[model samples]
Target: MLYRGSCHCGKVAFEFKARLTGVVRCNCSICSRKGALLCAVPHESLTVLAWADDLSTYTFGNHAIAHRFCRTCGIHPFAEDVREGSERSAYINLNCVEGIDISVLSIFDFDGRSA
Candidate 1:
């Protein structure tokens, strides 16, 4: 299914195809603090619709994942990284999705803090 996502200020926008199941709740510092529920989509499945240049990136630890956020609202709408399988994908923040009943989604807890 195609879903629309954006930052709080709407400065950044994107469209992606995801089933919205198996969203991950990670214990990593950044993710835990932000309370982000993420879902992965292959790079080809996501498209930035606007304000690509207005996004800022943050990386730490291995510095392999690019945590992309909107410069205006500082909302991290998505992140990009190559998984252990050596394939690139975007980890979409479900909080930024335009319209969806988040309460009904099945979430999986990931032990990222220990990674």
Candidate 2:
């Protein structure tokens, strides 16, 4: 299935193709605070549909992920794995996806705080 998503203010928009089986809820500091339900996909599977330049990135700890958000609304839409020597991937915030019935999808807990 193809999904469309954007930040709260719609400044950052994107689309991706994926048959989502589940989403992960991470307990890491940022993830915990943002309350994002993330679905992982290969970076190549994602396409920025609009206002890509309006997006801002934040990184912490090992800096392996570039958390992307809308500067205008401060909504985290997705994050990208930027680690060298690793296959690129994107963690999409399912909360931002249109028409998704999140309650129907399996939710997995991730102990990211200890990772």
Go through the candidates in order and give the clash count of each.
0, 0
- Give a tens-digit lDDT track for model 2, residues 1-115: 8999998888799999999889999999999999999999989999987664788899999898999988889999999999665589999999999999999999999999999
**Where in model 1 is the C-alpha error above 4 Å?**
82-86
* Pairs in clash, predicted candidate 1: none
Looking at candidate 2, what is the lDDT of residue 59? 97
lDDT of the candidates, in the order given: 0.89, 0.92
Q: In candidate 1, what are the lDDT values of residues 37-97, reduced to their tens digit? A: 9999998899988765789899999998989999888999999984566478999999999
Q: Give the C-alpha miss distance for residue 39 in model 1, angstroms.
A: 0.5
